[model samples]
Target chain A: MKASEISVGQTFEKVVVEDLKRTQLVMYSGASGDYNPLHTDDLYCKEAAGYPGVFAHGMLTMGMTGTLVTDLFGAENVRKYGVRFTNQVWPGDTLTATATVQDIRDEDGRPVAEIGIETVNQDGKTVVLGSATGLLED
Target chain B: MSDEKTVTFPVEGTHVMMFARSIGDYNPAYHDPGKGEGNPVGAQVAPPTFPQAVAQFDPEYPLRIKDGEAWFGSGGSPSGIEGKPATSGGLHAEQHFEYTRPVRPGDVLTARYSQGETWEKESRRAGKLTFTERLVDYYDQDGNHVCRARGVGVRTERPVDQG
Candidate 1:
């Protein structure tokens, strides 16, 4: 949707990732080179780190959240993006990412849209919370 | 960490595509540069969180979580707090990204990595929490500020039987 078309407080469609799998985390680790044992090696996590099992990488979830904005605004138009990892994400957990338009205004001669981003897990717990802004084309 | 250092990443189309793939993002702009022809940064733009992944290439990365170098009680922590080993892993608390220009393939970018802000907080599970915030400012080959990134990680102790 165009920046002009988006209304303040208007929330876009939610992107839901269901039953998040371990393979996805492994692939992300290989791709991002963030092979922290907490995200892999269940035995190590249970013995050394003292967690139930592996958890998703915060960047992986943040990147997943970014998909919400970039889907509508495109990656290049995203001028600012941010998030706070509020809760842990484990395998089999479902996450939903949403972006609500906070303001649609003109910056200089171009339109800019500020959005509030949030991702919640199945239990209605916020896994990641943050905001973002994108430049809108005329 | 040290004061500051220059970190660079050699951009490649395959890596960009791989990043998009990793996130299961099927955006054409990331795979088919032709879709982004009219955009200012050219086609095949990097995803918004692409720089976070590229941080591994930096030899001077402050917290090597994967290496287990900065684990709690390791004394390698920025806070220099000493304590018994913690059972739980560290957490990535927050992140921020600001961009001046969209990154594209063939664009050589350099980032200055430095510490932002840090503090201590008492926690129930962990004795005390040391939160370290890191920053990276990206510059293009032409020396134009392309983007900036800030990240925060927290270390603390946790119960062994968190099960």
Candidate 2:
């Protein structure tokens, strides 16, 4: 959290989700108001849409992956955060997110930490890749 | 791609708490009503991607299953809309957020949406990807700029090849 304490290449990791559930996707749909059936409706995904089954929303994975940034810098300390959803995350998949320090520098007179982030599924396939810049406490 | 729309989003503690839970973040600072008083932000704040939840407030949001109108998701059958393709709905490709300040409960914010960029790409898994960027700027009730969210949505020509 403190600019002085963090060094480049330091990594922080957390298992964001284990055995991803359709119910969690439903909760996300209700919470975020995205009712895309590709996320919550299995029959629709399999029968109508032609996918294997229901999949997690891209935002859901991004939201889950955000725990790394929020846990490290605090939600309010985030100056900029972004991500690219790389792979589809399906039910029963486990996701682990890692954030590695990329730089510690000053921007506009404020100490900032630039961090690279990646979230991978159980098979080690990258589900999301992105970066964030957070304001340091110092 | 040149259309603009605006919606009013009133940040609520309960909504923030639920959103955090959906993301599996149980940090008391995001949910506990008075637990965040000691935080540097001085109040309970929404998660970094919480701005996307503004879809709940959009009157014409196409994602939500509205009453009287036929819904896309299943009820009695696989899909209410006949012959709807699985790849019909667009997918979120990228999202970026820049904050002037964290969103706090009780903050009534205005979200103005504007089109950004459009491009095309080809992928082995999905053919002919059309990507569009949309930008939303949030301003507090006092007219102070609070945050900006840039999102890229991609539409595939067909269902993504799983193999």
Best by the lDDT measure: 2
Clashing pairs in 1: A49-B87
Q: What are the RMSDs of all candidates, in order?
A: 4.9, 1.4
Write one digit per residue (lDDT tens) for candidate 2, span A15-133.
99999988999999999999998998888888888899989999999999998899899898899999999999999999999999999999989999999999999999999999999
Return the DockQ of model 2.
0.78
Where in model 2 is the C-alpha error above 4 Å? B1-3
Q: How does residue B66 of candidate 2 score in lDDT?
A: 81
Model 2 steric clash pairs: A49-B86
- Stretches of candidate 1 off by over 4 Å are B1-3, B36-42, B60-84, B87-89, B159-163
Considering summed lDDT, which 10 consecutive residues are worst modelled in model 2 chain A?
A: A41-50
Tell me the TM-score for chain B of model 1: 0.74
lDDT of 1 at B49: 89
Candidate 1 lDDT over B10-72, as tens digits, reads: 878888888877777877788887775335555689889888766668774433453545443
- The true-versus-predicted C-alpha distance at residue A71 of model 1, in Å, is 0.6
lDDT of 1 by residue, A2-71 (tens): 7657789889856557899898888778677676667766765555555687889999999888888888
